[model samples]
Target: MQIITASQALMPEGWQSDVEIRIAADGRIAEVGPMTTRAAHHLDMLLPAPLNLHSHAFQRAIAGLTEARGPDPADTFWTWRQQMYRFLDRLDADQVEAITAMVFMEMLEAGYGAVAEFHYLHHAAQGQPHDDPAEMSARIIAAAQIAGIGLTLLPVLYQWGGCDRRVLAGGQRRFGTDPDSFARLHAGATRHLRDHGHADDRLGVAPHSLRAVDAEGLDAALALCPESPVHMHLAEQVAEVEEVMAHHGARPVTWLLDTHDVDARWCLIHCTQMTPQETARLAATGAVAGLCPITESNLGDGIFDGVRYLGANGRAGIGSDSNVHIALFDELRTLEYSQRLRDRSRAALATPTAPTGRRLFEMALAGGAQAGGRDAGRIEAGAWADLLGIATDNAWLCDRHGDAALDTAIFGGHGQACISDVWSAGRHVVQEGRHIHRDAIRARFRAAMTALEATV
Candidate 1:
């Protein structure tokens, strides 16, 4: 058992002062109430850290490498994707683990308790299966274990090159797998998670996108993991929406809603191109819209219609899709700012009862937990003890208290310097604004990057 007293803590009811939180040996919150003299740790401000609903861990290594303008006059998502493929073509198992560990550590330090990784990179550089078909997946799982971050591992299914079902080509070969092969891979990976992963860790399936997997492929993938959470990239680009309409006779989300049983278990990564009608209809479903505003902005993907979606009571969560910027508050700030730019308004995501920062944070906690299939996102008795301790001594937080501190953390900050400590599954992984294993993880990651820089 562990006891921690907080000067102020954000509870389900509201912000409370002189709060004490108790954690059970099993890593779940045991009790929470007024402070007691017997305390093991203390915090100035505490907030329940949310899971990152989507990520591509390997992409961390190439975050800033794709910023240069391409030969084409019009550089777009397609061009960025080509650069991504080329970068991944030279990645090996060791480098994958190193890069992933660094990214996962950053996620924890930046106030994310967990990550739902959309892992699609599989096989060797030459497109051959490794000795263990799930070799790459094992590396990802291992990295999470090392970082002490809760993980929802979604082994992605990518079969084709486009919506027309063209055969996998070039760098795409490394991510492609037939249904039979994918079934075996998924089974092995799920078993590994069940046996080796932490109690809160989960396994799920991701159909890469509408462009990569046909209806039949998606059906098979869903059938293989009937009860698992399902994630897919949808309508991230105008070309993708247009291509899906051309090939499937309807927009991607439209077809999925018409055909599949998408519910709370489904999380669509990007619906940036959805019509207002599609937005309202999708909001009616309990499924979450996984928004990665930083990466969306980086790739020039259009802003999500947050005003309409949130007004319609839509569920949503944030993710560091490209791992370019892993700051949780930055993701929240970027999300709200994008809406302000699109709607010509301020405080666009705010609710009547709460400020914009509080509203977005609470909604993300709930929606991300739902998407991750984890018993978390609350500082309640049964939830996992994943908490973020904000440093009150920070200049931005000096005069702030309660929700005002959160507002500054999200909107007034450039990074996560205000997040002084982070606990994942009751384990103190980050303290004093850094991960516990930062020195070692950084050394390994730097070595891996140095080696890959010469090759890729």
Candidate 2:
């Protein structure tokens, strides 16, 4: 068991002072009460660490490599995707594990205690399955174990290149799998996790997108994991929406809601292209809108309609999609700023009871837990001990208390520096603003990048 005492802590009931928390051997919070004089790890301010609802861990390796403009007049997500595919063709399982470890460590340092990896890269370089069909997924699981980050492994079903059911070519070949093959792969991954993963690890299924999976394929994927979390990329780009419309005769979200039972267990990634009616309809379905603000902006994808969506009590969480930048506070700030920029207003997501920063933080906590299907997002007994320690003495947080501290940490643009410690499921993996295994992880990632650079 581990014990921690915080001068201030955010509990589900609200902020508490002089709180002491005990983490059981099983990684759940054992107890919470007023602090005693017993020896315990001390924290200046403690907050619940949220799960990153969506991520493609390998994409972290191609972060800055796609910034250059192609021959097209306007660089868009499609152009960036081509570069990403070219990069992944050179990646092997060892390189993928190293890159994923680095990304998971960075996420820990950035205050994300867990992640839902939207994994789709399944086959070998030449579109052939490895002897172990779940080889790539096992690499991801190994990386997560090394980093001590709670993982929600989402094995994606990518059956087609587009809505027209074209064959996957080039880098897309690595992600191709029919429903029958995907079922075996999913079972293998589940067995891998059961044999090797930590207690907090989970298995989920993702239907890559409407363009990649047809009605029958989606149904098969859904049947594979009926009660687990179901995630899908929905209406991320205008081109994608148009393609779905042309093929399905309705917009992506509209058609999805009409066809399936999308409820609280569903997490739809990037509703950036939704109409007001679609937004309201999706919100009413109790599905989480997984927003990746930094990646959305970097790809030239339009801003999500946060004001209208949240006003309808929609659930939302943030993710470092492309991982071009992996800062939790920056993701939240970018989300709120995007809404303000779109409407020419201030504190666009603030409410009557909570301020902007507090409101965003709370909503992210709830939505992230719900989307990842993890029993975390609160500093309460029986919850996973996913917590962040912030230093009140830092320049960005000095002399701040209550919601003001969160506001300054987020809006002051130096929030990452204030993170002094992080615990994911009672594993203290990050300390003093750095991941505990930073040096080793960095060295491995550097070697992988050096080898990848020669080929790409």
Candidate 3:
């Protein structure tokens, strides 16, 4: 068991002072009340850490490599995807594990206690499966274990190249798997996690997108994981919406809602192209809109309709999709800033009772836990002990209290520097703004990047 005391902590009802949290042997919060005795760990300000609902961990390796202008005058998500594919062709399992470990460690330092990896890189360079079909999935689970970050291993089902059902070519070959093969792969991955993963680890399913999986394939993937979290890329780009419309006779979200029962278990990534009606309809379904503001902006994808969606009582959470940047505060601030820039207003997401920063933080906490299917995002008994520690003495947080402290952490510059500690399911993996295994992770990542740079 582990004991932690906080000068202030965000409980389910609201902020509490002089709070104590107890972690059971199973890593769940065992108790939450006033601090009466000394504890092994102490925090100045504590908040429930949010899960990153969508991530392609290997893409962290290509962060700065795709910034230059390609032959196209207007570089778009498609062009960036081509570069990403080319880079992944040179990656092996060891390199992928190293890169993923670095990404997970960075996420912990950034205050994300857990991640739902939308993993699709399944095959080898030449599109051949390894002896164990789920070798790549095992590596991802292993990396999560090494980083001590809660894992939601989403084995992605990527079958076709487009809505036309074309064969996957080039770097896309690594992600190709039919429904039958994907079932085997999913089972293999499940066995690995059951045998090797931590108690908080989870398994989820992701159909790459409407374009990549036909109706029959999507049904098969859904059948493989009946009750687990179901995530998918939905209407991220204009071209994608158009393609889905041209092929399916309706927009992505519209067609999806009409065809499938998209309830709370579903997390739709990047509803950036949704109409107002589609937004309202999706919101009513209780599905989470997984927003990756930085990656959306970096890829030239249009801004999501946050005001309308939230006003309709939608669920939303943030993710570092491309991992071009991995700062939690930046993600939250960028989300609000995008809404502000779109509407020419300030505090666009603020409510009557909650400030902008507080509202966004709480929404993310709820939506992330729902999307990842983790029993977390609250400081209460029976919840996973995923917590973020903030140092009130930092210059960015000086003299701040209550919601003002959260506002400063989100809006103030150098917010990452204010992060003092992080716990994922009672594992204190990050301390003093650094991951506990930072040096080793950094060294391995550096070696992997050096070799990858030489090749690509």
Alpha carbon deviation, residue 128, candidate 2 (Å): 1.4
Tens digits of per-residue lDDT for model 1, 348-454: 88887899989999988998999898889999998999998888776777847888888988888843888888888898899888899999999999999999999
Predicted structure 2, TM vs. truth: 0.99
What are the Cα lDDT values of the candidates?
0.90, 0.94, 0.94
Q: On residues 193-244, what C-alpha lDDT tens digit does candidate 3 reach at each position? A: 9999999999999999999999999999999889999999999999999999
Deviation in Å, model 3, residue 184 alpha carbon: 0.5
Clashing pairs in 3: none
lDDT digits (tens) for residues 1-456 of candidate 2: 899998889899989989999999999999999998644589889999999999999999888878778999888889999888888789999999999999999999999999999999898897989999999999999999989999999999999999999999999999999999999999999999999998999999999999999999999999998899999999999999999999999999999999998999999999999999999999999999999999999998999999999999999998998889999999999999999999999999999999999999998899999999999999999999999999988667885888999999999998889999999999999988889999999999999999999986
Better of 1 and 3 by TM-score: 3
How good is model 1 by TM-score? 0.98
Off by over 4 Å in 1: 38-40
Per-residue lDDT value at 92 in model 2: 95
Clashing pairs in 2: none
**Candidate 1 vs 2: which has more lDDT:** 2
Q: What is the lDDT of residue 439 in candidate 3?
A: 96
Worst 10 residues of 3 by lDDT: 393-402
